[model samples]
Target chain A: MCPAMGDVDIDSRTWRLLEPAGLTWRCWDDEYIVFHPWSGMTHYLDAIAGTVFELLLDHDATVRGLAAALANQADTPATDSLNVAVRQVLRRFDEIGLAEPIP
Target chain B: MQLGAVPESALRARFRATGVRLRLAGLCINLRTDVPAVIEQILQLYGGYPLEPGAGTDDARVHLKYASPLRRFIGRRTLVFVDGEPLYRPMLLRHAYLMIDSALDWCVSANVTNLVLHAAVAERGGLAVILPAPSGSGKSTICAALVTRGWRLLSDELAVFRAADGRLQSFALPITLKNESIALIRQWAPDAYISPVFTGTIRGDMAFLRPPTDSVTRAAETAEPALIVSPTYQVGAPLALQPLGKSEAFRLLTASGMNYYTTQRFGFDTVAGLVDSCPAWRLSYGTLEQAVDAIEDLLARVRMDPTASRPAITTT
Candidate 1:
């Protein structure tokens, strides 16, 4: 599972400031963005990698839970396609920092 | 004037901004420019690839070149070029769109794969808020206000969401300022670095800002969905955490979005989940300082106790 980065929340195009340091985080153009000031480098979260990070953030929930939650909310029924899609997405997020294990 | 792809080398004298790459239809621009004040930003947003032209074989790939129509996006496909060039005539929409749209490939790339939003984002610790609104709204003003008052600037536009797992995608691009916003930001951040005004653009003398050095350098990062605030500039208005429901946020974000149809299912779910999970509010203010204080106050409530209040229930 990808780490959610604490109880933090994510907004589209908007950035969430992470704690303990000045690093800022957000997902832009499908890439995970982690910007640090001191060194002046922005680590862009890759697609698959970012999905993995996202999985970690929603870790408390199970795979089934995720699929169910999303399907219901988006008005789509949970199906094999969704499950496959979820796995595929999670695999990518795992590769990026978008999803990681709870630390 | 046409909406088809053109080679990059064809138009090299349009852009006044510098970014890593602008891609469309598999055509990529391996171009670069100098922004003594903003190049560090170029590097930060693009992970610090040297702007110096390389002599590698990769330079031969043809990229599209775009000029004209600065006020509104010309179309989807075209390479936009901008450099330090002088023009005798006054500028207008074409000039503005060239620079603004030039930086948009990043937006297109992120949106095609992830859900892209038209919003302003600033961070202050673990919490981040996505500020989405129409063009005339005070998003830029609020962006300048929030950044100067301690909110770490994430972006002034385009909130990207990972379609797969739903983390906030970060693009450390510089902030965009228009009209009154230029002076407002310069006044607040006197020591802050800003690009010289580019006159005759769509918005009239627009300005660009470099992301905080911190946001550009840290590449490997992610954030969960948090708050959604829609800022409306009403000078003299007060603060309100109007809890907008998920459905409302969904509609608002989708309507104000750049490419909701590009990513389909994942984009819909990602946007819906984001609106449902986080808090929402609409802030109206006459003064920049008032807006800043109101944000601090609202943020204090959210960080200290999210349950204390909810986004003002949005109706329609």
Candidate 2:
């Protein structure tokens, strides 16, 4: 079931995210280890965080959509906690140049 | 034909004229030196390696000679040249073999595309056991012991891992014994071929044990990783081997591997696969005997029960 998200900013709703160009990644047991060539940093990501990047790689995804994608991967319904986690992970991705939220 | 198959006269003539090219495992080295002791060391230490038959480009070109006429006679110093450029400071002329070892180390660590880790490697049953530790942690000492105990030596200084298949490539160079280890190995394995100790080298009283013939013969073989053990030698400490988690193993490998960050995501995947496929542990031991025994026991257990060491990975 999808919940109403009138309170959340539109910027977080329709924000387009994608992996940085030339980034590399590997996954083990659903956990992702990603390397950012520009920054020369290796990040360890849990299953949910990994799903977020995978979802964005195919097409631009919004926060709500990202949460839904993660839920689908895990074979569960999207929860409020999943949405909050997605938002936090996206902020981290932005800082690391892993993904950009474009207009 | 192997280097040993070539007569000393032919090797000497080759060394004096063009260079003596020796192929060891995946690397080919063309060495040019006329120094009698250096030549003797090469013929003696590298006797088991195959002679590079002018087939492909040599991976490294190293030349060792007296620094200058003045220094050659005065301090008796030698300079190491790689690709026609002097790469290291002049050291005692007697340190020519050390220069060769150092030059080869530089060549592979800087040039090879594989992810290089400063570790010792040995293989048994087609599985490589990687011992990645900082220098002076008794890595070579233990590695030499294992080789003497009939384990095939993959490498004593560098563990080169290919990213495509996550397998360890054999680099069966000599096992260097340093300082106290020099006397220790001689006493432990009297039959081992050890070079005469050269004092005043950078590492202090360094000697190299020639790699076994079997290891040199199988240098082209590659082995998938089965175990990664980080050793810390302590005096009077009881032998202890503790399980190291996968995340921690990945962290340690990234820290020690030279090209780990440069290879980016491929490097991450290579190491991740290695960690997931093998069980890692931290081993602490006081005596060489205890360490060897423990490692052999671990190998036996893993052989009997393959799944005991495999880490669990959740695909969903």
Q: Using lDDT as the measure, which candidate wins? A: 2
Q: What are the per-residue Cα lDDT tens digits for candidate 1 across A1-103?
A: 3434222221111221123144444664455545434333334455543553454444444445556766775688989776666555544434432332233
lDDT per prediction?
Answer: 0.55, 0.80
lDDT of 2 by residue, A4-29 (tens): 22336533555544445677676655
* CA lDDT for candidate 1: 0.55
Q: How large is the C-alpha RMSD of every model relative to the true structure?
A: 17.0, 6.0
Q: Write the per-residue lDDT of candidate 2 for residues B1-316, one digit (tens) a residue.
A: 8888887898898886778888755667888887778999888888888888854788889998888878756988888899889988887787877888888777766667878878899988887789988899989999998898888999988888876787889888889999988887888789999999989866778999998899999888898788888888887888887877777787788888877877766777788777877788788888889888877767766677677765342110
Could you report the DockQ of all the candidates, in the order they appear?
Answer: 0.02, 0.31
Deviation from native of the Cα of residue A97 in model 2, angstroms = 1.6
What lDDT tens digits, residue by residue, belong to model 1 across residues B124-208? 7757778898987989778877776666665677676766677665654556788888887898888766766767765677766
